[model samples]
Target: MRSTFSAVFTIFVTLSVCAASPFTKRAVTLPPLNGKFDYQIGGPYTPAADVAVVTRDNSASPVSGKYNICYINAFQTQPDAASFWQSSANAGLLLHKSDGSLFEDADWPGEYFLDTRTDSNRQAIATILNGWIDTCHSKGFDAIEPDNLDTFSRSTNLLTAADNLALAKLFTDHAHSLGLAVAQKNTGGELGASGKSTAGFDFAVAEECQQFEECDSYTDVYGNNMLEIEYTDNGISAWNAACKARGSAISVIYRDRDVVPSSSKAYHYQEC
Candidate 1:
């Protein structure tokens, strides 16, 4: 009788271990996805009657009662960001053209690249972003979305994917340690590669993934855990068709490219 009881207990433990969520490693993927989560980057506010999960910029205070993704500009400098980086103090990470002009994203001109050549330097660079991560964890954020993992391609190969993998893991591991799930932003070059995601990212927050033919790459790995934000009508149509055909219940949100709030003329929001 004792032997039979022991065998049953062992089988139960195996099933429990296999059922944990990718984020907490304890819970399974949070309830059934509602399919209409919000993506608001202007920083979290009280949110309106329609907004589902509120996503704020990394600078805002985190809120509970909803799943929040802290948007940290991990790879680049701040938007309109020239004044932040002093040339005399931090120069190597800052990308410069032959004419000494900075490489700005135009949309987010403030961001600058961080030099991640050595572990020591990477940690030093991470120090700035880690504080924000710490704040996100403490402020009640459920997850983090560190943007610009693909900046290495933009860096003209001065930065390698290996450099990003190291940093990505560093950020995600630390976030997980604090009980916050981390997200991998765009990097079509190698995001779906086996075991290449150093971040141990729980879910993927892709921007215009449908418009770019990259949805397949992410959905293949994250399953329906991919939270897609389509910036245009055509993108929404394309993503929905693919998702419906597969019976995949992916969460989709539509926002302007700028992702401005409802108060602005450029304000755009939708869910399907």
Candidate 2:
């Protein structure tokens, strides 16, 4: 009986060790996406990279590509609030003021935050966003990159870090169950033990990691499970140096801030 107990204990330790392995060894080869990939002002879809993430509303114009990341405003409402996504159903979760005005992120001026504090609200948001993740799965995306994980920080003391992490875990588990890996978009700076264990995340879609001098945090926490997008040559060079020196596995790409279509003179794309 003692021997049997020891064997079971050993097996448990082995499984735990394997599960906790650093993100480096699990790195994947990302195909180039150095083309016009728009996050706003959606129009006709075109295959831009090995993967193209386009807004779901633009599904009318499909990008005939190998992999796609259908963009859903999973965390917040788009400027066109009432057209298709009615705010009435999600009124409780929508950010509001004492006077009932919406909380605004001026850069994305019109979009308002969703109150992700309560379990009920989070689950409600999860249910709706799960539909979007399912749509991406049905549409054949290799992965789902849910933008604005950091938006809770923009929640004006109403949204706690714990609230964001809990909601993120909800979405992450749902995505995986549907057989799609999800990414923690642009949260490279916020990863830690308290990050609620970024365990289930497959990889990261980091923007400007080099420019922020925060690439090392990602390389350490996420290991090679990263794809960096830089908007400047200096950032690209720094990315290469940091990633290469650590023998880390990372795909790096450069793009114009606008990611303007090839028809535009301001269009820019690069891969390294």
Candidate 3:
């Protein structure tokens, strides 16, 4: 009986270890960096062309058989879901100013910042995000694109790059555990080799790399594993010049800032 109990304990330990270990390296095929890509975070519409990769919000289902990427607002709150967090038992999870008022993302109304200043707050936020990651995996997403990674830059000096990077690592690990590749969303072209290596991102989804003249920063790190999105007319012009110079080896697309579906009058989608 003693031997049998020891054997059972060993088996349990091994199983636990397996469950806890995430795939450190990508075990799935990555979206082609040069393939036509679309940003559909606002809403999903019919694919207009030979799109190779597409990103959509977590609440939406993945496009059938495409290299679908799930978008999660990991570092900041979504504007529409303000009340969801405000009314939660973990309301304190949101960042607060010195006077105790909730900090907001000024440009994005209704969107608040998540507190990543301490281990407890980071872990609490991760706990909430892990559920979304699980849903993304279960729903057959090929990868995850956690938006607002640059939140620390807008954190009003209350947060640091290290704080956001630590939170990013948590999300990256969780996505990998479920066999989902993770993409680094905008770090403002400032993620040096150390930053990229520390976060362990599998790919990158950059916004306005052309307009910002930071395309090299992403391509230098992720190689052909980067997707670019341009929002404005000038940004589109910049994208055209970049694509013409870089050739078909770079995936580029243009969409309205909101990325709304075709039914909306504001809907806009195009590819390079």
Name the top TM-score candidate. 3
Relative to the true structure, candidate 3 reaches a TM of 0.87
**Of 1 and 3, which scores higher on lDDT?**
3
Residue-wise C-alpha lDDT for candidate 3, range 64-127, written one tens digit per residue? 8689998888887766666667876669889999999889878767778898899878776776
**Clash-forming residue pairs, model 1:** 21-27, 76-112, 77-111, 77-112, 78-110, 78-111, 79-110, 80-110, 81-110
How would you encode candidate 2's per-residue C-alpha lDDT over 1-272 as one tens digit per residue?
00000000000011111111122222332333332233321323354555444423313333566444444555666665533334455567777767788776556766677778788887777776766666666666656666666776666677776787777777767766666666666766676534427435666666777767777666666666666667744545765664455323455656666555556676566555
TM-score of 1: 0.77
State residue 254's C-alpha deviation in candidate 2, in Å.
Answer: 1.3
**In candidate 2, how many clashes are counted?**
0
TM-score between model 2 and native? 0.72
Model 2 alpha-carbon drift over 4 Å, by segment: 1-65, 82-86, 193-199, 232-248
> Which is the better candidate, 1 or 2, if ranked by TM-score?
1
lDDT of each: 0.60, 0.55, 0.74
lDDT of 3 at 8: 9
Model 2 poorest ten-residue lDDT run: 1-10
Q: What is candidate 1's local distance difference test score? A: 0.60
> Which candidate gets the maximum lDDT versus the true structure?
3
TM-score on alpha carbons, each prediction: 0.77, 0.72, 0.87
Model 1 lDDT, residue 226, Cα: 63
